[model samples]
Target chain A: MMTREKFEEAVLPPVVALLVAMLVGDALILLFGQSPGAVYRMLLEGTWGNAYGLGQVLYKATTLTFTGLAVAIGLRAGLFNIGAESQLAAGGFMAAVVGLAIPAGVPALLLLPVYFLAAALAGGAVGALPGWLKARFGAHEVITTIMLNFVVLALLNYLISSRFKVPDTLHTRELASGRLPRLDAFLPAFHGSAANVVLLLALAAAVLVGWFLFRTRAGFELRATGLQPAAAEYGGVKVGRVWWHAMAISGALAGIGGLNYVLGYKGYYEEGFATGAGFLGIAVALVGRSHPVGIVLAALLFATLSQGGLAVNALVPKQMVDVLQAVVIIAVATSVPEVRRLLRGFRRSNDA
Target chain B: MMALAFLTQTLRIAIPYLFAAAGGVMTERVGIIGLTLEGYMLGGAFGAAVGSLATGNPWIGLAAGALGGLVFALLYGLGAIRFRADQVVVGIAVNLLAIGLTRVLLRFLYDSSSNSPRVPGFNVTSSGSGFGALAQNPLVWMGFLALPLVAWILYRTPLGLRIRAVGEHPAAAISLGVPVTRVRWTAVALSGILAGLGGAYLALDQHQFTDQMTALRGFIALAATIFGRWDPKRVALACLLFAAAETLQIHLQGVGAFPSQFVEMIPYVLTIVALAGVVGRAVPPAALGRAPE
Candidate 1:
């Protein structure tokens, strides 16, 4: 009963809502006793004016890109993966341990792969617990994921404070021993930017994920399972396997975000280091409408907001940025009906 | 003596969770998952703190807290029920809004981020002998009483039937001339009231109003609701279980039995294990998360 034109009709509302939100956000700036035009200019300059600022934006984007992909994958499969936060924490913690534990003389080629693998495995394990429960026991992912989040937070708190306490500090040991070699020399151009070779890896993963979702038979099975589990089961798709695989992929992507954080920013993990990056990934996925390319753009937009928000802190409270973010999400969500009605009206007008 | 002390501590801690879980049961029973419990609880805490400080009366503070929660919950109901917004997203937004609003209000009211002026505690009744030492805050008794009251109201009353029917099959109920939206709205409002009371109790009874006062009790209440199979009595028992774990962690610290951090994790770890084990079989309200057509 659905058509491509109807799909387009559904999409238009969110886009219009976003544009309106930007305008309203600017208006909010003016109301807050700041010049909207000046603020916008500062935001642009802070996010992308200098090479360093642009690099920081890109670095932040790279982390968001991976986590956004993680959330998007789960959403596409009809699973709300709120567990991304915990999974990311687990992955980052595991990567930190592995990166720190390795002897100093290990080859970068081997060490990098090992650290990534460790991170992925840790994250995947956390994701699989909920996936298994959902598939086998009919447990809801939302509740399970949320409960797991508390468990992970408590566990991380214990680990960082006691077991893995880096000598005298509350943080882990610095990454002097097993640091991921900076891509500055290799790339030469994007120096001072954490936009490393990992971005390429993230891009490849995104392409592979896209291909798996759209072009492959398993991808079709996953989508079908998500659309209607009863129908998919009747049609002979392995519903359980799809849930597991989707969650595994989702968790791995989230883990990659953690790895990116460690490798790019602190070069070591600290307590509460990833600070809700996993949750922000949810906003990224939603704003992007769960598309790969859309998520990339959403991440960049969010990164810009993050940087710009800090820049404007001199004039307005930084909390206003969060308010704007929340407004954008609400506006986008509410736009669905308005956009649909507008399109219907437009078509009627055209017909008339 | 130690066991008695432990039991008393557990009951005291469980009271707030019991209140919030009861609210969750009411909303979920009407086919609406009440994720705004956190917001309501926090708002209640803030309202109670401010009201008690301004009026110098615990009861007034409690009423104010409940009112704050009711207002926020109504906003949530309007968005989710009237506008047909995504319930989960709206719930998360409400939680974020509550946090921001509370912070902003805190700054406006106290001019300090750390603590609010202490208010008078709720009056407590002392039992004669064996449990006299264990006699806790009056709100604990009120919370316990609410369990049976809620159960009776939910299962035995005509209003309860309507609420259940709305959750189970809203369209069918509507066809039968029931006001489905009204039932859902009322249920959500009631949820807010209960969560707000829980929050007020947290501030007035346990500790003075602090920013992190309601730390994750809202989520824990949600967990208890699911764990208890959305039944008032079972939810109360689940709250007791969590509270017992918390009490044990505290008691263990007194005896130097386990490290503080590890002991603190006991409740969370146990919750995950319990959820993985027991939650798989429990069926939620049939219409939960689905808007009425």
Candidate 2:
């Protein structure tokens, strides 16, 4: 029932919230006895100060982009998929297994697809459980997904410490001979950097997701189910199917997020390597208003903050970064009502 | 001997969760699903530690912990009831805020991150033998004793009727002249007090406090609230079930039966299985997460 104009109107609130959050964050920096102007300069400098920093920023952004998309997809379907962390862990573990198990004689081109597929399958299966339960039994996904997160974490911890433990290290075995090619080798011009072609793939995935959600019939059905399930069912939409499909797709997206980590940065699975990406993905999805393009922008912005946050640790406590992220999420969530009121007021004023 | 040890361990682990879940049932019965139970518990633990450390009196710490819970519950009530914020989002925010604020305060107060100084233990005495072989913390006994009392308050009291009425049908209750908002707020605040006391027990009973010590207990309490089907008696039973699982894991570890990591995973895994099976038909309050119009 949201017209194009109304959708645009809905978009303005998150944007304003982001601006206000930034202002508040800057104020917080000042309260911490740091110069806001200098901090901003340092943030930009840290993120884009040089080639290495930019590469790290892009590298971090690539993983976040996928996770953000995963969360956004679930949000669109009215599901709060907090299990992305566990799904990512599962996917990363599986991908590491696949990457290591492949025959050394195999070509990189052939093995890459296998690694990606395995990760996607593992993550998708993890996601499917809560999705199926929600669809079949009307169970709340939030509680089940969170519980599953713990289950997955425990399972991963067991595997890494026991069966999958590399002989010498606390992580899995090094990736097989035929795995994702090194980013430096793939892009000769960007020598000695973590930035890879994965960024492009992430961008392409975002575009495809955007088109799918905005243009396709399935997307329309999913949105309809989310906005008003009763009405969607009345319109002959299979609400359960949409929920299942959306969650499956959401899981796959989160799985790819795990894939990005292995394929781009670490190239191996380490226990507890993903600190809080899945949870942070929730904040990203919320800040972006569950739109693919918005998610991409938000992910990049967060990636910059995270990267810059590390560089400014000497001047400010690292916890400040978390404070900023928390502020943004709180501001956006709390501003929704005000935004609606503002929009209604504007409309009334225009009519008057 | 093993069984006795297990029973004692289970009581110790279950007491905090029992208090929290009892509180959760009270709030949920009033139509507000409290997600910040963990935060309140953590606040209580920290507050108790700080107060006892400063005052050299464990009782004062207990009171301070309850006060901390009261303050947090008030914030949640204001946001969810007064401002009509999304309950779940507010819950998540409260949790994150608790994490950030706790860390900040720890650094400010203790100058360290790991553990606080030990305090005087709670008062308790063990006696008898055989079935009574298990000596219990006085707080543990109090937690158990509170169950029937809570059940009484929920089912036998006039205030309980008003609370249930508001939860079930706010408009109808309001039409009947019940102060719906006041009842809901009271339920929330009372839940906070219980959760806070649970947290205080963690510090005062255990004789120490540590960062993240109440890890995920709040979530477990919420799960217990659901598993109990929003009934005080059932919730206490659920808490005991979860606590038994935790106690079994600890016992297995004490005897070196399995790797500690594997033992630690039992509670989480069992919770998932329990949710999938026993929690299948649990119905939450009809308007549990909704804001009053």
Candidate 3:
């Protein structure tokens, strides 16, 4: 668990960044002749004022949590898995395909495990490729992962469009046994929302990731490698293996994210269903300080901003929310240790 | 005639890549990661479309596009250089900001989300008359010239020497009185201008700016710069090579030789393979991505 000091340190930068980002959003709103106060009020009303909207926010937050963990693990291992966009898609696609392949007489109770394994393996394989390449050939994972995104997405596009696409739709055929019961099944308030069992699963994953990262020896080595690779190598940690396994697990987290939409909501793999979710994960992980508790909170905050984009669309374009998200990232990035040092120097020079 | 047609198509596709790749080479060579190339290009495209639409002149629009990129570059500089923020994260933010800003502006200014109204641009009288179509576009001519000019400035000028010194060893160069920060600022400005012009070319060529129209061209050009190991002449060659692969994709799609998406994957696959040391190892500048202490 994060000590109180660590928690405060982790929370402060993102909180300041959020404030600064909101100021930017205010300026943008004013420039467009809209009242920022009214827009924000409407945004709050649309998102948290009602149970239905809250349910949708939770649904979005659930996916963000998984992707956030995906990225957080990579960060802990000194890797940047920018390829989560395709990794998520690959997981969903593999699950869909495997789900369809199961014989009709198979027990429905066995389906979830099979689909989860299929998704994890698929996402893991794609994630491991860049890791292996970096380890074996000294290739920069940044460029390799970015390139892999295009390659994997293109390959998936080919499969869906030319081979597996349902007759008239852009998505593949529906899965036979991959559906997870929605929250609306039990809760009367979330009647029309997509919130499902996956939300609880996401919570469980967070606890598991936290425990594994903090309590396990493997997690300590991974964090050590991230902090100082040369020192960790001298200390007997297999740096290469940590990177590989961290990436595979990271990919698995993002792959499980795909289930929220594919199994929980849609029951099929639709092209471009979760277009910006993977990138949003970067924002989540960053604001969360790569910690589970922080990640969950950050995901909820972003989920509010995301769903609130639609809520405030009458006052401004939904894209304004995208602008705010980017601004938040910029502010958060500028609040890193390096920038703080620069700020201190600037102040000292001014005083001198 | 057939070969000429093929070459013209490649040249058309290569114009944007050439501009971005050349700019990326300058920025990367100066030791600042040019991850915002995409952002600059997108900003330029949006600027060109708005400028041309307002003024009814492609020349003014082109100038506006360059200015647009300069504006965004300053934003990036504030975060990445002045504040010494994480370059990679800020780069991603800049790109996202460009996309969001353009979309918002598109809706605000043009009342459309997908595209702006058709704007004034260079006239192409002969669609099928080979290079005649490209000959009239001043930006196209400038695009081809940009590579050699960058190469000359890098290899043949005093400023180039200073840039190399700063990139290779900023601390040593600072001791020698080379202004590291100023040199980086200059390189980033030039990168934004040239990459913006590259984006302006796309909007002007199409006579309209669409949201996020630069797509991944900026990335492809950046990849070219890396593939060429940050050498101007070689980077230009890499741009053309990737452009040829794209051209092949289009042609193969037309002929139905392979699935369209698979064909589109060719260039990206090539970049991955080339970066995998199938070609050779790459050594970045010593001071690359490091904030000056």
Candidate 4:
């Protein structure tokens, strides 16, 4: 029962932006004297054709979903939390510490919840610091978050290298408990892939976030504060309190991403493991238009490109994926209005 | 001799930040956010590298870097100013683009993902000690002159008046018959050129272009801009202060008492502390991030 106009309004810009991104990507591939069509086919086959590829794609998506949700939540509150990278590190670090600390005999059920809770709290605490700074001192969140990212990065490096490093290794000790079970072990089809039950948790979290944003009182206040702080303040909303809460939730979401990477896949927290996943969250949130459902689709698309980059490594520069991702974000940022106008023109012609 | 070494090293390190922070001041003072300064720096760095590599002339590299930064800045202005896209989003997007483009081009040209071959640079090492050493590098002298030049343009000129007017209140400026968009575009483009020059200094100083050679100096320059309260003179001094932190970190690491990571955190932690109003309040120009409607 969906109308064409509704579909056009809702979907056309991202679709066209993605197509533009692909076109730019193809041009880059051609510059290397490779056939763009063949390269793309290889990418598709490597990311989607096999069970292992799909599993890898989904596994990456699991982390993206958490980071995407983190940024999206911040965006909904009119805050740009560029420090998701730092929050993820904090979460992963906390999870690693707690996982290693638990006595060897702890049950998985109890240990897993404890691990997740510790991560969320640690990340939330890190996230709330920036929020408190902003609310108290009127400091811009963008700069503070960026500064915090470097602080976290340096802190993590110091901790790992000085105290937590296992002998000469660049990572902490492996966990004795709290590791999430792999989905492939039960499914068999996803064999050889690290895709795990954490993906289900990611999906469930997305649903819960959607519910929280659209169907809750705090959500209404938060959105109001974002849209118009003065108006929201006049409406009896505690704007500062909302910033603190929104940032805490946002950081908690990014923190949960740590569970996916550490407990779900790596089984230990390593320096540089989060890598650029935190930054990629910005693109995912932007492309998805800050919607929960849209974020999943966008995350999958980006994850495919990432997995495919590895697939096409022999044929093209691995940096091609970075180009495509950047192009997609730029294209979406620049071309959305034009796409909307073009769609409107087409719709008017049809009406005539 | 030790004090002279510290001073020269601090000046050398501060040059890039001074250029970037000045550029940021220009753009932000004209009512446009200069988050794209990061991208501009990267673009300039890559351009300078390629130009120097191709021509074997470091001066040509400097020109190419400015042009590269100008192009990137213009693109950013087209989106954020002309198209009225969200400024922060466009800035972040442009930064990512610069990273990807620079790396890909680096690979295509040098066949390596990490760094480029050493090119000819201004040999300031033989320029003697103290002020003579600083004068040996043409770029360093230019950076020093740039501070006063920017201050003059920002304060004493008619264009500066118009720019400040637009930034403070674009609608008011429009009512007074000023072309707000054109002024902002010019400010942004000029800012890019300056930032680009800063990037150029990185490659020329190191005599090679490495992946991410700017090393987030653009962001630090932004901190400098804030700490300086968007004043050219203050920002120049702030850049030196930050550079001092870097130099001190290096010295501390050489002493080996503290962990290297703790030293690395100095500038970043200070920026956070400063932004949190520990030292003083830093207010941005009104209407700075808004597009003219």
Candidate 5:
């Protein structure tokens, strides 16, 4: 089953895309008067080479994994859930609010579940809006979801600014309890980094998601709907219901993504925090080909580049990393199966 | 006087939306997604700033802005049209690249992080702060002209008919011997020119290019295109309506404690509502976002 050809088919496109993206990066670095090799080495030394740097990379990857899964699940149902950014913020706000609302006497066991549910519910609610819109009214999810990002963020901004923000600051009061422990508690080498048990939660979510998408009947329905909605409906799948459920589940995953930053690291939700992660998750999901295992790897690759951008900032602008990301997405988009088939001389008129 | 000021402010704000919406309507009508309107505006803004700074001529800056947007549109066209990549994803990529490339160019060309040096622009100080001042800005007049020009071209021209034909039925158009690819390419280029002028409007009016400027105005314009249901006259009305909302935002500042953030949400919220078919259905072109056969 695991033939060399199959393995190559699975791995070749992203590998090729990454190499090409790096070449583009090299040109940019050189344009800025820095040796690409030296800068890249410095990047590696700063991220994968050092334990602390690796921890930072993992921390960033944890958030990406959640949001990436959110995007991938919706993609499976033929929805472009572009509101992961909005959902993530809503989730963080809920987590922060829930953490603060619970009585201090409550056991950790009870409080943790409450916070998690609150975050998930908040994110799911936000995610469900666009889904419901699409299902009931034939609205396009892309436009609605993009609009929702601005709407939800502004709503949260109004709430935090007017009602909840600590005076003289843009963030709310820090949670006094239920904060997740840092990796330094056990992994002493990860000192000074924000890596934590949330990484375990993310990995667990990935495994669960992988199983749900590949093994379950509902997951099959979602995938089938994505492939051909009319045929899926013919086969007895309620395509609209799948759209709603997929988006809600996708949103719930993105909501928990916020816990990695809010509860695990910052213990509070700050305005504009995790701003780009939602967009970056789109890149991650696409690059990973919407696979769980692949998303983890893609997340790590991006995290390295992101953390390394800071490392190489003295030599080249950190924005170079953003450029490389765009190039990578472009390369990946150009090579996806549909385009590949077109390039392979498939004729539109040929039914076979 | 206050009403006149409000009208002038609304008109000034409407200029960019008008230009960018025209661009959005153009590309989408020809079947390419108009997601890159934001990116084009940004490209034009930076290009206009650099041109004006180097040459001290606003007209030259305007041309540079158009060229910059054209370059981005071509890049997007290469990805979406030539490679037949997912149109939405390719559009997002170009937006990302535009932001990154602009930032890099900002630092490389000017060595500043937040803004470029102030440039010469069309806003003439001698004309005072009323309609006369607004009139002196040539771009504003062009902005006012945008909807009518597009409407006439779309309804009355052979090329527009071809564009509509390709969008609605590319296969039939191919059978009819129309060059579908060339028509789309031309349409996208035209979109770039229109949107590039919109971005130039922002830079020329502000007299500087700030970091990551254009700040979601392009999305609002895209929303206008949707809110108008892709009709030129309706889209112009949508643009004016959103521009008025923005104008009201400034006037409502600290009045009755209305949060400016809520006002900012008006356009996006309305667009989503329209898309939800609370209003009539907002349909796209039949061939929109389809991969080439």
Candidate 6:
């Protein structure tokens, strides 16, 4: 367990960033001629005041958590897997296909695991290609991953619009099996919201990832390679292999992230379902300091902002939240080292 | 005849990529990674649309676009250069900022979310002269001129040598009395200006600014810069090649020869393949993406 001091050190930068972002947001709101306090009050009430609002927050948080973990894993391996958006889309598309085509006799419980595995495999395939290219050909993962996003999105669009379209719509048919149960069904407080069992799955995945990263030899190798490839190579670690494994695992996590949207709520693959979640994951990873618990808290914070944006959309431009989020990410990332130094100085003064 | 028609479309499409790639080459050459080209382009597009709509002049719109790009580059420089923030993170932040800022601005300016009203486009006169079609838009002519101009500036000037020198070894350049941050800021500003022009062309050509009008063209241009070995002339050639692919995709869509989505994927897939091929052969600037001490 982290001591109180350690927790404060870990959390201070993001909190400062968030506060700074809100100040900037308040200025923006004032520019738009709206009362920032009123808008903020509405946002707070909208997201946390009712069961439905709380449920929506959890639903969004579920997706954010998975994608955040995906980005965190990539960062661990020193790769910026911006293709998580595409990977999530691919995984969701594959899951939709499997869910739709599975035998009617198969139980939901059995098919759930199949959906998860298929999504991971599909996402992993795309992820590993970039990783292999980086390891083998010395191509930068950033450009390759970015290029793959466009390719995958176009592929998904083709598959859904032409091959698997439901008559005249831009979505696939609703799946017959492997649909996750709505959280409201089990917990009445989530009634009418899209919150589902995927929230639990996301939390479990986070714990699993934390355990793997801290306890596993493969994870250590991956981290070592990221920190110092020459040193890792000298230490006899297969750095290239670590790259492939890390990227594949990162992609798998993003693929499973699709479950929050496709299986949990939509029950079908739809156009633009994974929009912006992948990019927002970068913010979550940075704000959380690339830790599992930090990621969960960061995800929830962002989810609340998004959910609250909808609540105050009538009064102030909800786009303010986007500005705030960007500001927070930039502020935290840029100020963390300086903040750390400041804290150290204060500690030294106290010691003296 | 068919080839001529294809070539015309290719030239038209390649202009934006050429402009953006030229900017990207300069930025990377000056040892500053510019992933914010996408954001710069988006800002330029929005600025051009609003400017043209408000002023009824394409030239004013062009200036507005460049100004928009410069503004974004300044913000980026503030973070990446002044504060020593991570360039990659700053680039990503710029993109998100552009997207969000443009959307909000669009809502305020046009009272709509998806697109802006059509602005006056340049006149296309067909006088049956040989140069009639080519003279359709002055911007296209500008695109033709940009390649050589950038090449001359980058290859044949003292400033060019200094730019390259600062990129290669900033410490050495500083020792020689070169201001490293100023040079980088100038390069980034130039990148923004060119990318803004590219974005303005999209808006002025289409006669409207839609959300994300630049799409992934900025990134494609960045890829082109990489594929072309970061040389101005080669980057222009890569832009033309990618543009040819895009023109073919349009033609293919008309004939239903291939799935349109597959056609859409061609440029990106080719970029990936090209990047992989060039990794060993085309070396990046020695100090690319490194901050000057």
Clashing pairs in 3: none
Ten contiguous residues minimizing lDDT sum, candidate 2 chain B: B127-136
- Per-candidate Cα RMSD to the true structure, in Å, reads 3.7, 3.5, 2.4, 2.1, 2.4, 2.3
lDDT of 2 by residue, A1-352 (tens): 6796578666876787678767966776776678988888888897788766677778777777877888888888888788888888888888888887665667766666777788788888888888888888777787778778877888788888878887867688777554454466755645666677668778987998989998999999888888998999999999988887888888877787776667666778898866578877877787777878778878887788788888886666555676567656666676666677777898899999
Q: After best superposition, candidate 2 residue B84: deviation in angstroms?
A: 2.7
Give the alpha carbon lDDT tens digit for every residue of B1-293 in model 5. 88888899899999999999999999989889899999999999999999999999999999999988898999899989988888888898999998999998888899887899998997575444577888888999899888788888788998899899888899999999999999999999999989999999999899999988999988999999989988999999999999999889888885856898898899999999888877677888888778656
lDDT of 6 by residue, A202-225 (tens): 999899989888899988888888
Task: State candidate 5's DockQ.
Answer: 0.75
TM for every model, in the order presented, reads 0.89, 0.89, 0.96, 0.96, 0.97, 0.95
**Winning candidate number (TM-score):** 5
TM-score for chain A as predicted in candidate 3: 0.94
Name the 10 consecutive residues with the lowest summed lDDT in model 1 chain A: A176-185
**TM (chain A), candidate 2:** 0.92
Window of ten residues with lowest summed lDDT in model 6 chain A: A101-110
Candidate 5 ranges with C-alpha deviation above 4 Å: A1-7, A105-109, A337-339, A342-352, B126-128
Candidate 6 residue spans exceeding 4 A from truth: A1-9, A341-352, B123-136, B278-280
DockQ per candidate, 2 decimals:
0.36, 0.40, 0.77, 0.67, 0.75, 0.65
The residue-by-residue lDDT of candidate 4 on A118-163, one tens digit each, is 9999889889989989999888888788888888889998988888
Q: Is the docking of candidate 3 incorrect, acceptable, medium or high quality?
A: medium
Fnat of candidates, each listed: 0.24, 0.25, 0.80, 0.67, 0.74, 0.64
Candidate 5 lDDT, A117-180, residue by residue in tens: 9889999999998999999998889889999999999999999999889998989888877888
Candidate 2, DockQ to 2 decimals? 0.40
lDDT of 4 by residue, B164-200 (tens): 9988999999999999988998889989999999999
Task: Write model 1 residue lDDT over A259-296, tens digit each, in one string.
Answer: 77676567787777666677678778877778788788
Score residue B45 of candidate 4 by CA lDDT.
Answer: 87
Best by lDDT: 5
Instruction: Compute the interface RMSD for each candidate structure.
Output: 2.6, 2.3, 1.3, 1.6, 1.2, 1.5
State the lDDT of candidate 3 residue by residue for B1-293, as single tens digits. Answer: 77787788899999999998888988888888878889999999999998988999999999999987887888888888888876777888899999999999999998998999998998778867468888888998999998898988888998889888888899999999998889989888988999999999999999899989998889888888887788888888888888887777777876888776775666667667766778677667778777877
